[model samples]
Target chain A: MSVLPLVALVGNPNAGKSALFNALTGARQKLGNYPGVTVERKAGRLALADGRPVELVDLPGTYSLNAASPDEQVTRDVVMGRQAGERRPDALVIVVDASNLDNHLRFALELIALGLPTIVALNMVDLATRDGLELDAAVLARELGVPVIATVAVRKRGLDHLREELGGLLDSAAPEAKTLPPERDFDAVRGEARRIARAAVVRETPSRRLTAAVDRVALHPVFGLLLLLGLLFVMFQAVYAWSEAPIAMIEGLAEAAATAARDALPDGMLRSFLVDGVINGVGSVVVFLPQILILFFFILMLEATGYMVRAAFLMDGIMAKVGLSGRAFIPLLSSFACAIPGIMATRTIADPKDRLTTILIAPLMTCSARLPVYAVIIGAFIPARDVLPGVGLQGFVLFCLYVAGIIGAMLVALILRMTVTKGASGGFLMEMPKYQWPRPQDILLGLWQRAVIFLKRAGTIIFTSTVILWVLLSYPKPPEGSAVSQVDYSIAGRIAGGLNVILEPIGFNRDISLALIPAMAAREVAVSALATVYSIDAGDDEALLERSLGDRLKDQWPLPTALAFLAWFIFAPQCISTIAVTRRETNGWKWPMFMLGYLFVLAYVAAGLTFWTATALGLS
Target chain B: MRLTELPLRQPAFVDLIDWSVLSPSEGQRLREFGLCEGASVEALHHGGLWGKGPIACKVGRMTIAMRRNHAAAVTVRTGPDAAP
Candidate 1:
């Protein structure tokens, strides 16, 4: 009869709130966007001890309700009952790091002043004890006039006790809990919070801090940069090496399925659609899933181990020189997996100019979708021998593609900062979380989420684009005994023919042009489009030798053209989802249009230059 | 001395923070993180390629990363009177 009681978890940035949320909800969580805003709304179902199912929402971490960042603003608004789409929380769980009580308590004290029914979760007590901290939770509860629970969210310690506390708090049509902490100025409140924190701590032993020890090596100017680069190189190499067998297995399965479809269906359009469009088309995109998953695995691990912020710390000076802050580095690194989320992540950067510059340059970071395009091209043209002792030529080429994107993004950011988005950059401020062993369940959950997104793309967007491409290439059958190939007479070919006038100068053949249009929907669709076109073309000329898509490409395209195609993807800005997200993030089409124009010009010139240089070098 | 000028690895007490030198939001953020007067502080490390970039300061039990320019507004004292 009543709406599910909404309980929100709130905390500072590094207070282990996410781990606690995962522990409480397990896999029953649902993620969506808060209406009218791009911030994530994460909610899950939690069954209280009284057999009542309540909604557990995880609010973004913030230091205070002062609304410093977009994330913090959302957290403040949701708790204050003014957020665009969220209802005011029925109760609040204020999570604070056990070791960092003095700083975290400032916010907790402020939240207590909001007069909401509240509980303090003394999270990460295990880490605190490891750091020689001994705290009395009873003192904290007594001082704040609310219940306090010590929890190690990652280890699932004290969770049942936490649940019992939650049940009791909800059971009382508890007389509206009055504001316990008195109103005071920011400084006074913080000072009182310091007093409370001191009272709660029974003893503070000076133990060898694991964070400082790790920071000595990981943040050393020379050694730290080297470590970051080395980790990246190894990750790229592993992406290519570890996923090889799985990729081969997927390709074999696709071939067998296509063969079965051809035999099961009659000789008509149904057979062609199943085999050429669904099988080979979407199958080409699906084959790259292993590489994407491997890439995400390394990223998630870097994030879990608390090394990502250190990477930003190391990059600060260089980023400053470009009129940006080190905070931009995290989003840029994430753009390697996808531009949509990377653009969304920019909300944490406070300055408008800096956030805009970061968004404009994000698409240049060779996204995982671009990986399939580069992999096929390099496999067909480049030699696979060891270029150096441990560097294979193919992997080196892949790494070069990634570097090209990074270099291009940096240059673009510099130019944009000096021109369209020019302004004084905002200062960087953040917490450096302590180093700890990454939990297996957290990493697996992250990987599982990415895998689901990848597969859904393969099923929906890739499938539809492939089917449409098949139809466009299959119709308008060429006349009997005619010299014109079936493609030349089809609708898609004529469309490519019109566009070839502009693209031919860059060494892009008609086939590449045909693949280009469909790829605008999503970057990975280009691979499927090419596979479909080639598969359909193969069926037309029965006398042609049967070959894999790579073999077909190698036989047809010149080395210069292949290299030019690879160069184009480094700066290509055609992903529809990326553009849509940019629109939502910037709240206008102006920046996205500018992004499209600049990237298009850059891609054309880069492809043309690669074509000319490779041809000039006698590699034609 | 301003916290930025405080010698590395030396423990000091925050004396006076010129909040006027910082933007409202930046000042509020610093206050929220407990980098106020009478708090114990130490400059841990300087990060950047050239080691002239942002300074990592220990304010209470947390390590806070802040740009050099922002750290220049907070005055600190390192004598016996600096003890909390």
Candidate 2:
């Protein structure tokens, strides 16, 4: 058997490192956490030209080897053989964005200085050509004392040649390819790189005149801010515009499935469980997947296009006012999709206090999981009447809810910044990369991954939770000749009813109280829980369940109480995954517990205030 | 001083080398881009549209942005001022 060689991939952000990894490894890859940290590590094996395998480790992206962040530190540790019990790869595939080679080479130069057997993988060559830039690969390789390979990783253009070259290098195992001169040889290498770079790399045109011209207008205080807001408005509108058909289709299919199950099963516990408990509970949340996917698609596009950096830059002043850096904006923006990623992104912020502040406020961003509950309640009660001449009242209310989250996060960040620090605040500094049109392939890749994750969560957490909630609300039939509904005798109802006294302050009745239990699994599960509870007798009819909710709230519960319930759902920080992630990220129960405590206080206070104000106004 | 104090369109030599070796902050940015101490680099242009324009250099790989304030720090050493 031939000896297998090892290859490592390294790059700065947006350098197509992962694309190259995918091209090399195909579908064979595994994701694992880097020892103790939550930073993901991906590794795979690629067969060489000689049929021997080459192990590939795709290192986390970092700007430089200075290693300020944990992700960067991992890269530095692994490359330097400082990671205990980890074997350093034989050769480093230094991926550089061909369009932004100059900015990227600073890191590349550092990697070259590390004296590893290194090959420069100049990625995005096609994009570079489109920009009218050219690189002399041979001359560049001569300059750096390493082979240079131009690759369009997205297209799988250079993999064959790359494999061939690497296989030959490994087969030869040339002593020169395997060793560095000395321990302190970096200064000489750096000097040599400068001399060679000056000779090899040349600019046909020495200007970013186009970028500057665009930025001048876009970064203007007055117009830039307006443009940013306009961009966001368009994104939200697209979410609504594009997702409507898909959502309706899914909803229709679910209703149909429920109907079919009802007809197929005999009128008994089996029929009730299948139709009401299982189908209704899971179906309610599953139908909202389209809107969630649409929202994530736009988010991923904006991120890839580098427009998010501009948004962060524009928001820097506002963030600074609240004692946070522009860096917090990245995580906060990510939090708009989900708090887990938003918390994970806090690693970018250097200051501990600022990182913590960002993490604490992340859940307040109103993730997509809450959208189902919001949509259901708003659709049912919130008047469709427009306040403006042409604007939608429903959309306006949704906008206000989003605004409330932003304001709440800022308020908390401000309070924490003042209290935690003795008037010393963390400063935000960041690189503002030139904006480019988002690559369609990259955007699609990101969107596909996000959609898969949402589907996976829906399949596992929502599916299983719905079934469990269904069983809890279905089994142990009420006694013979019982006047009350079967659900009234179910375990879920009894538990929720028992808790209603304490929840009475927020105007939660037995049904609402019971819904909150499954909601801990996911905020959206509350809708399914409600559906399950209502459909216990209605069987598989979704339309009937929807009407039942409307009727139950309108007849049994006052408008003020419903409004209070809405307020509670909006402000209550539920979701076990979120709290558990917080615990993991913060590395303790302290912050998660603190988060739950304060959010509950806020939820109750908000609900109570809404109830009182609505009652005072005599709305119901 | 800061790069903001340097006069625009001036040809100045950076005195310091190995800028990437500095703190991963803005200070390191100046050094890494060959704007180090005693190295000759010129800011060829300023803002055309954006409030801050991309400064093209006669020196390194990356073009660093020069806000109006920092563009004044680089002292020119051309013609009579050129050190032999």
Candidate 3:
């Protein structure tokens, strides 16, 4: 009986290694955490030459063998068997982008010296040909002494050939490749790459047309900036316009379900919990799914089309003004989608100080999940109408909120850069791929996956929290002889009233104060919590809360106070996930605590300023 | 002539140098296109209005923006036009 061999897949970003992993493993793959770390480890079983099962490990993408970030450290550790409980891969598969072999081969050459039995898969051959690149696979195979298979992972072409080559490697008695000599490492390998390219590579025909078109538009200073802004405007409009109907339908369904559940059940705590607590709490929060999906859809499309890489180019000047390099923009952009991945993306920034600075500021970017809370509040209080002909007042307000987040993030980043980690700029290097239309299937799959995740959270965390909130606010039967409401007697209301003392300066009443506790599950949960609390008070409420709030707020809190509350949530650092991820990324609680403390101070100051000014203006 | 003085549409092959040495917001782009010191490339096309768009040049297998400063760095001898 023969033991199955272990194989590792490695490459630079956009080299199609992940696509190849999907093609090879199909349904046999499983994703899991690597020991204690949050970095994902994927393993799959594949049939080798002798009909034996082999395990394939797909490693994270990296530029070179020289490790910088934690993710890159993982790649080096796994390959060299330095990781605890993780074995070294028996063989290596170096995926190369055929269109831009120069840069890809630079990394490949370094990997070739790692002394593993290796094979090369030249991916995106069609792209290479379309762009007039010519790579002689036969010559490359001879030079590298490894089987070079041309593959188009997206089209599923060359799988059979890849499989056959893998079989040959599994069976052959070819000696393992020689490792780099003790004195020589990356610098040596880079030197060898230059020598090899100079000897063998030559441009048969220069690529001119497509690049000319792109350069003319993108390299022009003023025009490029305008195009970038236009693209951003369109993205924001799509987030609102595309997701509107779905949001309305979701809201309608939730309300109708609450009414049905309320009418069917007896007038008791169980019915209230179901109607006002769980259904109202979770449903209102989940309604933001369409908006979040629309936001991510545009982001992923920008990423896939390679324009995002260009935006880094476009943002360098702006970032420099804030004491960050253009490289920081990638992580910042990632934060706008989700801060977890954004923190992880900071690994690409190279410099430890720069990475830390970017991590500290990442959460300040407004994520899509925050949109529902903003939308509900803004729609209720901000007043939607045509500010001018064809200009949406609500849309303008939304834009301002986004701008506020950006400005806040920049301010924090500037402070961090000037005070904590003043240093020299790191070397910035990135590969910009040829521009192409984004793949539709990839976009659909991405959107569907996110939607499913959001719905799952709704079914679990949001649902449980809502039901519990309902129960706490509904119990003790309101002491039938008493004049006060049941909720005023319940645990939730008592807790809120107790907490109101601390929040008094911020002008939060008991109901607003009560909402903050459950909002820890997510920032958006505050809106749903408020909806649940108010729905309980109103008892299967007639008019929407916005209208009621408009009147109630005018009478009680005043406009400045209302604006202050909005500003508090905007900068409060209320997200638990952001805190958790920050801890995990920094490998400590220090940064997360610092983040929370500063954001709270900022929120308090902003709210205080707003409240005082409004009172002074006699708006209350 | 110095590379920067090369007339419009003149084909040139040159080594890419430091991008920051050229201009701000400019280096980010050259880096994006995989053009850095010691990377060999040729500017094969040019001419476009600023803000309207970038002037294009062939680099590797892709067409890329060839800013005036960047064009100045690359020295080339006339060859058969590689323009499509």
**Among all candidates shown, the one with the greatest lDDT:** 1
- Model 2 lDDT tens row, A383-479: 7776776556776777777777788889888887887533555554445554566546656666666777777787888878888888887767788
| Candidate 3 lDDT by residue in tens digits, A49-152 | 45667888889987665665667777878776677657777788899888767667768877776777789998887777766666677767777777789898
lDDT of 3 by residue, B1-84 (tens): 334454545555443354445544445345434454444454433332222122345555444544344455554444555222
What order do candidates take by TM-score, descending?
Answer: 1, 2, 3
- lDDT per residue as tens, model 2, B28-82: 4454444544555655433323434333344443434433333444543553454
Q: For this target, which candidate reaches the highest TM-score against the unseen true structure?
A: 1
- Every candidate's lDDT: 0.89, 0.71, 0.70
Task: Tell me each candidate's i-RMS in Å.
Answer: 1.0, 5.9, 7.0
Candidate 1 per-residue lDDT, tens place, A343-378, comes to 999988888898999999999988999999998998
Better of 1 and 2 by lDDT: 1
lDDT of 2 at A406: 85
Per-residue lDDT value at A265 in model 1 = 85
Lowest-scoring 10 consecutive residues by lDDT in candidate 1 chain B? Answer: B45-54
For candidate 3, the chain B TM-score comes to: 0.49
> What TM-score quantifies how close candidate 2 is to the native fold?
0.86
Candidate 1: misplaced stretches above 4 Å? Answer: A177-183, A540-546
**Tens-digit lDDT track of model 1 for B17-67:** 888878887887787778888888999988876557888889988888999
Q: What is the lDDT ranking, best to worst?
A: 1, 2, 3
